[model samples]
Target: MYLTAVASLRAGHADDVFLLKRPGWVRDTLKQLDEAKRLSGGELFVARWMSGVVRAQVPGLFGERAAAMQDLVWCLAHADKAPNLGWMREVYFHLAALHRQRGEDAAARRYQTLSGFASETRPATFTTPFSEAPVAGHTFSSRLIREVVPGAVYLLSGFEFTEYYFVVSADRRELIAIDAGTRADAARAAHEALRARVPSLPPLTTVLVTHAHWDHVGGQRYFRSLSPSPRFIGRGNYKDELAHDAMANPAGLQLFFGKEFQLADVLSYKPDVTVDRPTELIIRGTRFELLPTRGGETDDACR
Candidate 1:
């Protein structure tokens, strides 16, 4: 029964139709999950939690809002039994959004606080790029941009897998970008979105890479296409780091990055400028101090 329920859920996800257009799929999945929970003698906590989540999303499709609220509250009541703090955080975040949608500002704020608490309490080991679940507050198909330093620095998030930033030079005539994205298309889309948002954004003059990870450098080719091109800067050990990763199992890399990932793009990435030691660069009147560090993910990391 549990295996059947899992299969049902996967099929529901595979459907291309919007949830609202497929209420039968949602209802069927919920029924399967409930049966799985019962057959497991209530030992299937993950199934139960997933049922609650499915129920919560039903209001957005074809159900009563009150029913959705009840299921969300039930999920919170069972939060202590969650597989991980990350899952609990997701519940809180979802509840917050639901409350806000219903114009319950106070309840939304309370759940937002709880969500932040869950995030802070979550162990670092729970954080991984390979989670099948989507990141909270981030939609892979959308881009979110925020001005981190009023008019000077901005952050671009919600790329397929990573976030990058833009810093306007002191003269506001050039932009220094921090990191590319996971793919050339993603980078292009993000850049176009950023340009649309900040119509006056300057031309990219420099790109500072923090690491040589595939996700960070896969979009280098897009930046290189700019007229005159931005100067790409990265750690001098970039080649050696890529060489080391090349020895890793191909299946393992595909599992983490998805089958759509291209090894050749990552392998062909090369920065125009490399730094091995402490160095400082001044681009368009903005001073950037680069420091090397042994990052948790890779040795070729800079800040």
Candidate 2:
């Protein structure tokens, strides 16, 4: 499909190219085109595309024709039909024109001779290698640190679940925590630790959720009881979204239910914090760049 798309684009099929959305839709087509190239008497669409670019390569290949001639002859000879040969001839002509422009008539003549020889030669089969062996799995460990890079901090509460949070500044010298702790104690401890480090302990700020998952958004209510109580950052119709997701995905709902129960059992609070959308606060001096991406692991994912 990629070759087909490339061909279409080269042939001025802009609308077709636009509709295909290269990365998403054209991958399958490109694979098909590759398969066709492998078959003895299949489509030469990709070759046609290559021929256009190849033909246009002559001026650039002025002193390099002798080196490129073999590949050119191969492209011309190793295709199954007349149109393919015709495409090769068109490419040859373009290269010839380029050679003429560069005053290399002898080199042009040499390419013309090779093109004629291509008519006498036949298409040869091509093959690629494949591996069927399974690969081995690997594992690695990550370290825990408190407030390593300002907004980004690693809070470890004895390995059950080590969480990281990106702190966003809140109104009236308060802060909002993004991706709070796994348990209530972890969340409150993290808040206190951050406060102690910053010397602004009381009047704790809000807590936000990256997604509805237990691990990422586990400390929701714990931090929500601050003086200005933290608010959960979610979509416009978050409740509806959450309900739809829970119903549609039973396994996902089960995962959240267990975490929610655990969080509720161990919940602790500081002060009250209000919640609202468009929470445009600087996170520990690092500004978050929001980019839309496919979200499966978290409610919101940054690509």
Candidate 3:
């Protein structure tokens, strides 16, 4: 019956995507679908995945916000028809994306773990290595800090979560780094790289964080380890963001796998410089204007 209904719908439309806000659509239709139809077919699975994602992702895209995921949940309840999305990794990625849209990183990572991948790691490879895996198409290295702008802007792909940035003065006498990644390793590597390639490149006087998310500030402590200990700067809401993280930090370990340490050892960052309102500063001939943003990915995204 599922295929029959989909076929009827597809007969008129050239496209495959359909957006039905009603959860009853899938439940009622699937309930009447011919039992002989194979639910495991890839096309059907894609249709179901779209249905699940739309429902699971939106907070109030529909008039009813609370029951958004109800249809998707119903589909998941069908033990047999449901796709092997659990360990297959594909559906797991979509579910993770939906959860992230809901601002539930922990919840997303929980689903991600069942698929044998944890974002807390490098590229979130499987924890339980079920099948002989091939070389990952994607690899991440945080320590390699490369200059995006000659003698000026630099970026360090710090970790799976955090990426750091550096801005140097025209004279190469003063510099500021931004957003240290998730741990001390990235910080140490970034400093070592800078020291090796451009030993004469300015002293890091300030380090600015774009937001208060753990991935943005987790490795902040290690910035103090750099020469002269650059001051950490964040928006005025920085304290509130930190307070929020401090409350949620404990649960983070359970959400995403903690790399190389126990949950109790995980630490959140504290900012040194706070800019309230739009503020402009001229330090060592470099002008910086700090502005706060309400939300892009987090509640405290700043510019």
Cα deviation at 277, candidate 1, in Å, is 1.8
RMSD of each: 15.1, 18.9, 16.2
On residues 180-227, what C-alpha lDDT tens digit does candidate 1 reach at each position? 766677678788888998899999989999988878887778888889
TM-score of each: 0.54, 0.35, 0.48
* Native-to-model Cα distance after best TM-score fit, residue 233 in candidate 2, in Å: 2.1
lDDT of 1: 0.72
* Clash counts for the predictions, in order: 0, 15, 4
Cα deviation of 225, candidate 3, in Å: 2.8
lDDT for each residue of candidate 2 in 22-120, tens digit (9 for 90 to 100) = 333333433443443455243454544343433344334234344344434555565443332344554465455556656888977766564454432
Q: Give the TM-score of candidate 1.
A: 0.54
Positional deviation of residue 70's Cα in model 1 after best superposition, in angstroms: 18
Q: Residue 49 error for model 1, in Å?
A: 20
Q: How does residue 151 of candidate 3 score in lDDT?
A: 76
Please state the error at residue 110 of candidate 2 in Å.
89
Best by TM-score: 1
